[model samples]
Each structure stands twice: as structure tokens, then as C-alpha cells.
Target: MRILVTGGAGFIGSHLTDAFLSRGDEVAVLDDLSTGRPGRLDPRVAVHQVSVTDAAALAAVVDAVRPELICHLAAQIDVRASVEDPAADARTNVIGTINVLEAARAGGARVLFASTGGALYGMDAAIPSAEDQFPEPEAPYGTAKYCAEQYIGLANRLHGTAHSVLRLGNVYGPRQDPAGEAGVVAIFCGKVSRGEQPVIYGDGGQTRDYVHVGDVADAFLAAADAPRPGVWNIGTGAETSILTLADVIGQVSGRPVEPGFGPARPGELRRSALDVTRAAGELGWKAATSLEEGVASVYAWVLAGEPDR
Candidate 1:
């Protein structure tokens, strides 16, 4: 199989790229290198420094690559940043996705979109949210992603494409930037490495579905090989509280963690987790890494000086 992963040099994307490479697939990357690093990818894969918002360039690259599948992972991923500047978020998250879809259409490639699970579900949604739940996103980032998902469905209907959506949980693993806004696990590991306590906002009661990057990569692989188009949530289907996350990291790192509680961020979800039964039955995929094992991997990576590969 020939695959092109947009943002393939980033943390999760790089891991997914490696998974494809290990399976003897020819893989390439299209990334702006703004937050993604080429050093994280296998040298055998070619890297194209193109932003997804540039439709013509993306189409040209897709035409040249002629991939069987295009894994669209590039986006404006920061929720807070999206809240502050919604138009900017839509430019990258929404417009960029449309550009990718159009490029895929011209290049005769199927698409697999990466979406968010926790952010897409509203607070009123049942815990361990299902795919059928109506989305009431609190931030513009989720809204933009949902809009992009709409485009994916539209492409499938109008063009008869087999594009799919993977609604992801909180992904954490090596190659994740510790200072980044979304990676709280990596951030906590960085703090523990510096002999500092992790900070817990909102009384340490807020919870999220934490999924490992390796498992997430596997989920993408399964989705790519599946014969039909569908929407699935990739997660453990269990909620881990911020306080418990701190404890797990401490246990993994051989350090005692003491978290300082701060005022909860306004409009934060009290609880969120995905109901991934649909993915399990349809895609034959399930998250395998536990919180302890996942945190241990991050801690070990941190201790190893956070190598790119």
C-alpha cells in the first residue's frame, strides 16, 4: 500500500507513519513542519513541506504520490487557541481538510480523517459517549473538526469515496512536546523529571479518555485496511481523572507526586470518555496500553532525553 500522512512528522502521525513502514508499505509525509519535526520520522519516508491549506500544492503532491490512502492528521489542534481565534482555527482545521479531500479526489486516494472524541461530546452526553450522540462542543476547535467531518461525509456521498473518521481520545506518548497545550501526560512527565509537582486545574476531578499513541497508530492501520467507510471512536472507553493521572505518573516514575489545585478553567467538561464498542466490533481495534504502561513509556522517553525517533 502507498500512503500519504499529512502532519506525519508530528507525535502521533510519526508513530502511525512508522506502523505503515513496518508493514512494508510505501509512506510519505506532507507537513508544514511548524509544530511537527522531520527528525521524528523514518528516513526512508519522503517528507513534503507543504501546508494542507494550500489546495493546489496538496493536489500536486497527492497526484505525484498516487497513494492508496491519505491519512489526514494535520489541523489546528489547540483548543484554547481555537477559542481565542476561531477564524484562524477554521482556516487550518476546516479549510485545510477540504483541501485535502479535494486533493484526494483528484489523486484517486481514500481519506482517513482524525477527529476528537472528548471535545465533540457535550457535558450532557452520557458518560463513555457513543458515536451516535449529538455534538455540543465547548470550543471552536471541536466545532471546526466537526465541520471538517461533515465534509468527509459529504465527499463519501457525492464522490462515492471511502473516507472515514477516527474520533480520538487524549493521545499521549513519546515525541509529544511536553510544553504543548494538549499533551497533559507529557507535561506531567516533564514536571516530574524536573522534580516539580504537577498542577491540577479544577479540583483534580475532571476526567478524560487517555489513549496511547501506539494503540492509536494501530487503530489507524485497522481503519485503513477495513473495506468500507465509517466513523469510529479510538479510545480505552474509560475515564481517568487528573488526580489519578498524577498518581499513575508518580508510580511509573518512582517519584512521589503532589499536585497543586488551581481554579478550574471556565467551561471545562467535568467528565469525558468514549464508547468504542463500535470500533471494536467493526474495525477489530481496541486500546491495549494501560495508564501505567503508557505513562512509563513517556517517563522513559523523557529520561532518555526525548530522542526524535
Candidate 2:
């Protein structure tokens, strides 16, 4: 199948692109290199240096590629940035999504949206949040993603556009931008590598469901193969505290460093985890990699200087 992956140069999208290409699918990657690095994108995959906000460019690419499937992953993913400037977040996550959907609809392509599991569901409602739970997004980023999800659903209903919304947990692995707000694993690992004590916010007890990027990529692959449209939570259904995550990172990197407590950021979820039972039943998807394994892979990659061709 021919597929187009927006933000395919970024961490999660790159992994997904690799997965699709490895499965013998022709792939085209559209990325503006805002947060996505150029080196991370595979040379074999067709590359288009364009932002999703540019509807004309996106539409042209979609028309040329005429992809049977479109994996929309490009967005302003920083939650803090969203809080600072919500309009920017909406322009990217919401408007950019509409552009993708419009281009896909014009080109007769199906879409697979990368929605946030934690952001959409906010704090833990039922220990591990399920898809059916009401989403009370505390931040602008979550609100934008949720809004986009609704647009995707509407597009499916009205335009006959098929889409799968993968409400993802905290996905961490190699190639993740350490500077970004979402990349706690990379940020912690980088700090620990430099022999600096990692800073923990709000008593270091805030918990998140850390799913591996590879596992998240596999879920997208499964979504590509699955029939019909649906929303599914992609996570391990387990919560790991930030304190424990720091310890695990130190252990994995073989670097001993203390954690310093800092005041927690506002609008941040205290605890977030997802129940992946629906994904398992519908898409036969599961979070296969452990946090230890995922962190170790990231640490090793960072130690090796993040090489790509």
C-alpha cells in the first residue's frame, strides 16, 4: 500500500515510517523540520519538506502520492507551549489536521490520527483510563487534540473517510527530542548522561504510562491493517511514578544521580494511564516492550550519538 506519514522525520513518526517501509509499503514523508530532525528520516523514503499548515502543499503531495492511507502525525506536540500560546497549538493540531483530512478526502485516502491518550483523558479516572471515559482536557494541547479527533470522526461520518484514532500514552525511545516537553525519557537520560541530577516536579510522584516508541509504532501498523474506524487506547495499562522512572533511567544508563524536586507545572495531569483492552480486542495490538527495555534502548542510542543514514 502507498502511505503518507506527516512528521515522518520525528521520533514516533520516523519509527512508524520505518515500520511501514519494512513491510513493503511505499512511503512518502512530509515534515517541515520544526522539531523533527532531518537526519532521523530514512533516505529511502520519499521526503517532502513541507509543513501541514500549508494546505496547498499538503494537498499537492497527497494528490501526487495518491496514498491509500495517510498517517497524520505532524503537530505542535509541546503541552507547555500550548499553554503559553494556545492559538499556535490550535493552528497546528486542529487546523493542520483539517488540512490533512481535506487533502486525504480530495485524494480519496484513509487517515490514522495520532491522538494523545493522557491528554485527552486528563488525570486517571478509572486507574487506567478507557476510551469511553469522558475527557476533561486540562490544557490547551489536550483540547486541540480532542477537537481534532472529533473533526476526524465527523469527516468519517460525512465524507466517508475511514480513520483510526490511537490515543497514545507517553511514548519514549531513541530519536525523541530531549528539549521537548513530551520527551521526559530523553530529557532525563540526557541529564543523567551528563552527570546532572534530574529535576522532578511535584514531589516526583506524578505517574504516567510510558509506552515504547517501537510499541507505539507497531500499534499504528496494526491500525493500518485493521478494518473500519474506531478509537483505541494504546498503552501498557500500568502507571509508573516519575520517581521510579528516574531511578530506572539512572540504572539503565549506569549513571547514579540524585533527583531534585521542583514546583509542579500548572495544568499537568497528576496521574495518567490507559487501558489497552480495546486495542487488544479490535486491532490485536499490545504494548510489548517494558519501560526498562525502552529506556535502555534510548540510553544506548543516546550514548551512541543517535546515528542515522
Candidate 3:
């Protein structure tokens, strides 16, 4: 299969691109380099330095690639930044998704959107939220992703396209940017490597379903092989508190590391996890990497000076 992965030079996208290439699929990438780095991708992969927000250029790439499947991973993923400037976030996460859907439609390609399970469900949501739960996003980033998902469903209904949405958990692993607002695992690992105390927000009791990027890449592959259009929660169905995560990092670092506490940021979920039973039944996908193992990988990557590829 011919696949085009937008933001394929980023952390999870880069890993997903590798998965496709490993299976003997021809893959291409579309990234703006604002956050994605070209060095993360394989040298043989053709990367189009185009942002999904640019409809014309994205459409041109889509036309040229004529991919059978498009994994849309490009977006403004920062929740705090979304709260600061919602319009900018919408331009990237919302409007950018529409542009990808349009390009896919023109080329008769199917789309696999990278939606957010961590941010979409609100603070009051169930411990393990399902696909049927009402989305009560606290920030523009989640709202934009949810809105983009609606467009995907609409496209499916109107055009009979089998585009799918994968509501993802908090993905983290090697190649993740430690400086980013997301990927607490990467951030904490970086802090541990530099001998800095990890900062805990709101007593560190807040929890999330931290899924590994490699497992997330596997989920994408499974969804790509499935012959249908539907939303699936890709997660471990387990909630790990921030405090517990810090403990895991300390254990992986092989040292005693204390943490500092700070006031909780606004528009953040208190506790969230996705019920991935549907994904298991439908896509044959489940997160296989344990938190300890995943954290160790990130720590090792950080120790290696955080190589791009």
C-alpha cells in the first residue's frame, strides 16, 4: 500500500512511518518543520515540506502521491497554547484536518485521523471513557480535534469514504520533544537526566493513560488494515497518576528523585483513561508496552543525546 503520513517527521508519526515501511509499503511525508524534524524520517522517504494548513500545497502533494491511505497526524498539539490563541490552533487542528480530508477526497484516498482521547474527555468523564461518551473538551486543542473528527464522519457519510478516527491516549516515547507541553514522560525523563526535580501540578494526583509511541504506531497499522470506518479509542485502559509516573521515572533512573509541586494549570483534565475494548475487538490492537518499559526507552533515548532518528 502507498501511504502518506502528515507530520511523519514528528515523534509518533515518525514511528508510524517506520512501521509502514517495515511492512514493505511505500510511504511519504508532509511536514512543515515547525515542530517536526526531517532527520526523524528514513532517507528514502520523500518528505514534502508543506503544512496541512496550506490547502493548495497539501492538495498538490496528495495529487502527486495518490496514496491509498493518509495518516493525518499534523496538528497544533499544545493544549496551553490552544487556550492562549484558539484561532491559531483551529487554523491548524480544525481547518488543517478539513484540508487533508479534501485532499484525500480528490485522490480517492482514505484518511486515518489522529484524534486525542486524553483531551477530548472532560474532567468529569468516566475513568475509562468509551467512544460513545460525550466529548467535553476543556481546551481548543481538543475541541479542534473533535470538530475535525466530525468532518471525517461527515465526509464518510456524504462521500461513502471509509475514513477512520483513532482517539489516542497520551502518547510518549523516543523522539518525543522534551520541551513540548505534551508527553509528560519525555519531559520528566529529560528533567531526571539533567538532575532536575520533576514538577508536579495540582498535587500530582491527576492521572492519564500514557500509551507508548511504538504501540500507537501498531494501532495505526491495525486500523489501516481494517476494512471499515469507525472511531476507536487506542489506549491501555489503565490510569497512571502523575505521582505514580514520577515514581516510575525515579525507578527507571535508578536514583531517588524528589519532585516540586505547583498550582494546576487551567483547562487540564483531572483523571482520564480510554476503554480500548473496542479497539481490541475491532482493530485487533492493544498497547503492549508497559509504562516502566516505555519510560526506560525514553530515558535511554535522552541519555543518547536525543537523536532525531
Candidate 4:
């Protein structure tokens, strides 16, 4: 099978690309290098430097590659940034996804959209959000992702495509850059490695469903092979607080971490985890990486000069 992964040079995308390649599928990448890195990609994969917002260029590439599946991962991922500039976020997350869908339509390809879990659920959502829960997103990033999912649903309905959405938890692993808009795991690893204290926003009590990038890659692969087209949340179905995460990183680093406090960023969820029962039942996918083990990998990666590939 030939596969094209947009943003395939980034953290989660890079790992997903490797999963496909290891399975003997021909793989290509489309990344603008805005926040992605070429060094993260394998030499065997063909790399295209283009943004999904450019519809014509995206369509041309899709037509040329003619992949059997397109895993859509390119998006504006920052929640606080989205609050500051929603239109830009929508342009990339919403419009960019539309371009991918249209491009996929031209070649009769399936799409697997990467969506957010906690951000999409917002404050009023159930403790462990299920696929049926309504999303009252606090930021444009989540709203745009949900809107993009809607477009995918529409495509499936109007054009009879098998496009699906995978709402991911807070994904972290080796390739996630510490300096970029990384998750708490990478950031904490960077801080601890540098002998600096990680600053926790709010009271250090906010919680999230932390899932490893490798597990996320597996979830996508499972979704790709599944016969049904639907939405699934890829997470561990467990919540770990910021304070606990800091301690976990400290434990992994063989040192005690003392974190500083700061005001919580707007649009941040207090406590969120995904009820992944559906994913397990439907796709036979579940996160296998324990938080401690996952944190150790990041800590090791940070100590190793953060290699790109």
C-alpha cells in the first residue's frame, strides 16, 4: 500500500510514517517545515515541501502520489495561540483539511484525520470523554479540528468515502521538540535535563490523558485497517496531573523535580481523559506505553542531543 502522511516530519507524524514503512508500505511525506524537520524523516520516504493551505499545490501532489490512504496530521496545534489568532488557526486547521479532503477526492483516497481529545471536550465534557460527547471547545484550535472532522463526515456521507477521525490524547515521545510547541512531557524532560525546574501553570493540579507517540502510531495503523469508518479516541483512559507528571519525570531522571507555579493559560482543561473502550472494542487498539516508561524515553532523547531521526 502507498501512503502519504501530511506533516510526516513532525513528532507524531514522523513516528506514524515509520510504522507504515516498517509494515512494508510505500510512504511519502508532505510537510512545510514550518514546525516540522526533514531530518526526522527516513531517506526511503519521498518528501514534499508544501503547506496544505495551498489547495492547488496540494491537489497536484495528491494526484501525483495517488496514495491509497492519506493520514492528515498538519494543523495549528496551539490552544493559546488559537485564542490569539483564530482566523489563522481556522485557515490552517479547517481550510487546510478541506484541501486535503478535496485532493483525496480527486484520487479516490481514504483520509485519517488527527483530532484532539481534551481540547475538543472542553470544561463541561464527561471525565472520560466518549465519541458521542458533544464538543464545546474552549479554543479555536479544538473548534477548528472538530469542524474539520465534520467536513470529513460530510465527505463520507456526500461522496461515500471511508474517511475517519482519531481524537488523540496529549501525545509525547522522542521526536517531539522541546523548544517547539511541545507537550508537558517533552518540556519537563528538557527542563530536568538542563537542571531547571519546569513551571506548572495554575496550581499544578490540571490533568490530561497522556499517550505515547508510538501507541498513537499504532492506533492510526489500526484505524487504517479497520473495516468501519467512524471516530475513535486514542488514549490510555487514565488521567495524570501536572504535579504527578513532574514527579514521574523526576523519577525517570533519577532526581527530584521541584516545579514553579504560574497562572494557567486560557482554554486549558482542568481534568480530562478519554474513554477508549470504543477504540479497543472496534479497532483492537489501546495505549501500551506506561507514563513512566514514556517519560524515560523522552528524558533519554533529551540527554542524547535530541537527534532528529
RMSD of 3: 0.7
Weakest lDDT window of 10 consecutive positions for candidate 3: 177-186
lDDT of 2 at 167: 95
Task: Return the number of clashes found in candidate 2.
Answer: 0
lDDT of 1 by residue, 46-92 (tens): 99999999999999899999999999999889887988899999999
TM-score of 2: 0.97
Which runs in model 1 stand beyond 4 Å of their true positions?
A: none
Return the lDDT, model 2, position 127.
71
Q: For residues 113-209, what per-residue lDDT tens digits would candidate 3 score against the true structure?
A: 9999999988778879999999999999899999999999999999999999999999999999887778889999999999888888799999999
Cα displacement (angstroms), candidate 1, residue 46, comes to: 0.6
The TM-score values for the models, in the order shown, are 0.98, 0.97, 0.99, 0.99
Answer with 1 or 2, whichever has the higher lDDT: 1
lDDT of 4 by residue, 97-174 (tens): 999999999999999999999799989889899989999998888999999999999999999999999999999999
TM-score, model 1 to reference: 0.98
Report per-prediction Cα RMSD to one decimal.
0.8, 1.1, 0.7, 0.7
What residue pairs clash in candidate 3, if any at all? none
| Greater-lDDT candidate between 2 and 3 | 3
Predicted structure 3: lDDT: 0.94
For model 2, the superposed segments whose C-alpha errors exceed 4 Å read none
